[model samples]
Target: MSYEADVCIVGAGPGGALLGYLLAKKGLSVILLEQNAELGKAFRGEHLNEEGEAVLKSHNLFEAIEAHGLLRMEKLEYFNNGQLFKTIVADPTVGHLGIHVPQAHLLKVILDKTHQFPHFTCMLNTKVTQLATDESGRYVGVVASKDGISIEIASQLIIGADGRYSTIRKQSHIDMAKRKHGFDLLWAKIPAPKGWEPAIKMALIGDKQLSLFAQTNGFIQIGWNIEQGSFSELRKQAFTPFIQQLTKAFPDLTEIVVQHIQSWRDFVLLDVFSSHCDSWGTEGLVLLGDAVHTMTPTGAFGLNSALKDADCLASLLSKETIAQFDVQVFQQMREPDINEVLTKQIEKEQTFAANFLETAS
Candidate 1:
């Protein structure tokens, strides 16, 4: 099968989906492709900061997503040895320090809005095999396989929002510099105890950071940091002793933890690293979100930055004709802010332990 669009987005992630919707709303033909057969098949980095909220609101999407389901963090509470020592309340005007949005809710709202445009197309269970390039070595389209059927999509602009491990970035020969944060994360979700407040709770456990985020749908998401590349060795240890630390930090979770997290199998390990590309695009192709500037799950900046990227890129594209598009301009406009966020994440990691000590003192 063959298709054509003004823009072909290679990932139906938050950034890509939002970009597709924005472009289509502006009257451009758009095709969004996702390898996953369904949305929200996996959830990661669902937290949205103020920047992301503003972006969604600017597009009049925040309320729609909120209607689906969301939880607002009321404050950041710091605990040491299971004792709450310091609390930072949310701003009165904003009413939230951060918001927990399930990827399922966010994507469904955006894609549903996108479907209102007759020129918008979403292709699920499709994987791009290769970039289609012309004799001049400029990307022109993509060749993909959709449920065992080969398909081709031609577009004037190709966008790679495929994620940190981006095939489009690799095929475009974009160079990315990767940085390994000192820790990886073990994530698990358990039922929230009745009367749990919507807040982010932090604790220091043997120099590692443990966090509990109150999530929508009556759940608490746990993020436990471990030394980089240490999960395998750690798993060999007695699960009871290791899991007991969680109860020590938040005794209130004892009942739920015992019920939900039985073994190491209950936790999902995420290898954490941040990356940045020297260039976001080449000729007819461009990259956004994790594809070009991957952020570690620190300060919950990754999702928001990607949302801002989509908003800015969509604005820029809306103002230009396909023949006049320039990816460099977009990079120039966004790189400074992105670099500042990256630097802050590193500094936050280094100071995290000290912050606990200072607060306890």
Candidate 2:
């Protein structure tokens, strides 16, 4: 099968979906391709900082997302030696310390909105195998297989939103400088404690950090930091002591943790990494979100930054035709802000111990 569009997006993540929606609404034909059969298959970090809130609100999408489900965090608390050391209340200027919304709900809502436009088409279970290039060696589109059927999707422009391990970026040979944060994460989710306030809780345990976030679905998401490449050795040791340390930080959750998290299999290991591509776009192809700048889940900047890219790019696309699109202009407009956020995330992770108390007024 052959399909042609004014804009071809290779991933249905936040950046691609949002950009597709904006372009289609402006009467431009857009084809959004998703390798997965549905949304929310991956462990998308469900966090929205103030910048994200502002972007959604600006687009008049925040109300719709909140109507689906949203949890506004009340405060951020730090614990030291099993005692509360500091508390940082939610700032009114910043809206809230954090907002949690399931990625499934957010993406579904955006896609549903896009469906209202006749120019938008979405393909699920479609995986891109290689970049489609012209004889001149310029990127023209992508070749993908859907349900074992090979299809050629040719477009004026191809947007790569396939995330950190992006096939499009890899196939295009866009080199990304990678960095490891010296630590990985163990994530688990269980029912929230009864009468628990919605907040982000952090504790220093064994020279590492344990973070608990209250979810909108009445669950508590726990992320424990461990030395990079040490999970295998650590798993061989007993789990009781580690579980007890978590209970010590929040004693009220002892019974809940005991009931839900029994074995090592209950936890999911997250390999932490940060990377930035040497360039974001070339000619007819461009990259966004984790594809161009993969972030550690430190400051919850990944999803929000993707939205910013989509929002900015959509603004540019809505005003100009594909022929007028300059990939350099898009890069120039977005790179500074992206770098700023990246630097902030790195600084936050590096000096967290030293500035732990300073964060609390």
Candidate 3:
């Protein structure tokens, strides 16, 4: 079977969903595809920096998500050797240090709004298998599978927003130049302690790193950096002491971590890798978000960058410049900004301990 639309976006993530909403709002026919049946995911970066907030507000999508429930971190505290040393309170003018909105809520709100436009369609449980190209070998759309049945979706433009491991990008043979951060992440979430104030916490864990993010759902998200590819060996060495180290830094979390995180299985491992595509667009196909450049979660830039890309790409598409689509226009506009953020993230990861100690002193 075959379907057609003005724009076919693979992956109903933040980027794809928002782009779909934007194009559909402008009366363009769009189809957003999601391999997952549900919007909720266990491990998505939920941090909403000021830039992402501004994008949502600009699109008039912020209030609805905020009303749904979001957590505004009141402070960003730094601790050294298990001792609180500095606190940066959220400034009203600059916006809270950061806000936490579940990916589920953001995507849901965006899709709900998109549905109001008759031209927008979201296909859940559909996975793109390959790209559909014309005789001239120019890109057109995708060939996907739904419930074990083949379905072809042709569009004027095909966008790869499928995420860091983007299928569309892989199918298109885009070269993603990858950079390793030399570290991995272990993430775990448990219920917030009683009367726990909402804040972001950073702690130095015996020369390593630990961070805690307060979530709107009454959970405290805990993330710690480990040496790259060390999970197996570390788990075999007894995970209790490592977790104890975390609890030791934040005594308040002693009982909570003990109760909720007992084994290595309790923590999800995130391999830290960042990449940028050699080229972002070709003919009728373009890429956005992690599909174009994968950002590590260091400075909370991943989500916001994706949002920015979608916003800019929507504008480019609205002008219907595919025939004259020059990847340079989008790259020239976005690369510098993304480079700045990525540089900051790198600096933060490298000198975080020194900066924390210096600031504390």
Candidate 4:
């Protein structure tokens, strides 16, 4: 099978989907490919900050997403040794400290908006196997596989929004600098207790961070930081004593935690790392989101930064013809801000333990 478009986007996450929508809305033919048959297949970066909210609203898509469902965290509460010590409320003007937007809800609205444009095409369950280049080695399209069939897609420009371990970025031979932040995360979600308020509850356990984020559908997301590469050894230990620490920090969740997280198998372990590419583009291809700059989940900046990337790139693309497009300009415009966020994440992680200690004093 063969397809062609002005823009070819790999991945249907927030950044890729939004870029496709924005480009297609401007009347540029776009083809978006996703290896997954469905959106939100796994636990992903779902927290939306003010920057992300601004991008969604600017594009007039936030309301549609909100209609689908989202949760607004009203405040950030810090706890140490099972007692609340510091509380930071959202400014009245801002309305929320953070927003929990399920990726499914976000992608549906953007993809649905793109569907209104006749030039937009979405290929789910389609995986790009390799890049197609001309005599000059300029990327012209992608060779992908859908099910068992080979598919070829020709495009004027290709985008690598496939994420941190992006195939497009890999095939393009982009060099990425990776940094491990000395910790990994164990994530689990349990039913929110009756009348639970929407907020971010954080606890410190022996220099590690434990976070509870309230979700839209009466659920509480748990993120527990463990030593980097220590899950295997940690698992060898008894599970009961480990989980008891959670209840020790939040006694109110004792009953639910017992019911939901009885064994280690219930949690999904994430290898925490951040990465950056000095160059985000080469020839006819460009990378955005985690493909260009991957962030640790500390400040919930990854998703928002990706949204900003899509927005800025779309704006730039709108101003030029395909022949005149310059991916370097996009990198220049976005690099500084992204680098600042990456640095802030490191500082935040380093200072996390100090915050709890100061409160105790």
> lDDT tens digits, residues 1-361, model 1?
9999999999998999999999999988999999999987675989999889999999999999999999999999998777888899999998899999999999999999976798999999999999999899889999999998999999999999999899899988899999999999999999999999999999988999999999999999999999999999999999999999999999988989999999999999999999999899988999999999999988999889988999999888863577678899999999999999999999999988986767554
The list of candidate 2 runs beyond 4 A from truth reads 318-320, 355-361
lDDT of 3 by residue, 77-187 (tens): 887666788889988897698999999899889888976788788988999988988999889889999877899998988999999999988898889999999889999
Compute the lDDT of residue 5 as modeled in candidate 2. 89
Clashing pairs in model 2? none
Q: After superposition, how far is residue 361 of candidate 2 from its true place, in Å?
A: 21
Tell me the deviation in Å of residue 149 in model 1: 1.1
lDDT for 190 in candidate 3 is: 98
lDDT of 4 by residue, 231-313 (tens): 99999999999998999999999999999998989999999999999889898999999998999999999999999999999
CA deviation > 4 Å runs, candidate 3: 319-323, 356-361
* TM-score for each candidate, following the candidate numbering: 0.98, 0.96, 0.97, 0.98
Off by over 4 Å in 4: 359-361
Q: Each prediction's Cα lDDT score?
A: 0.93, 0.88, 0.87, 0.93
lDDT of 1 at 74: 98
Number of backbone collisions per candidate: 0, 0, 0, 0
Model 3: weakest 10-residue lDDT segment is 318-327
Which of candidates 1 and 2 reaches a greater lDDT? 1
Model 2 per-residue lDDT tens digits across residues 1-361: 9999899998998778888988898888999999999886787788998888888888888899999999999999888656677889987777689899899888988998986887799999999998888888878988999988999988888999999999999998989999998899999999997798999999877667789999997999999999999999989999998688899988888899999999889999999998897788887888999999998889889999999999888888853667668877888998998889889988887777773555345
Question: What's the CA error at residue 2 for candidate 2, in Å?
Answer: 1.1
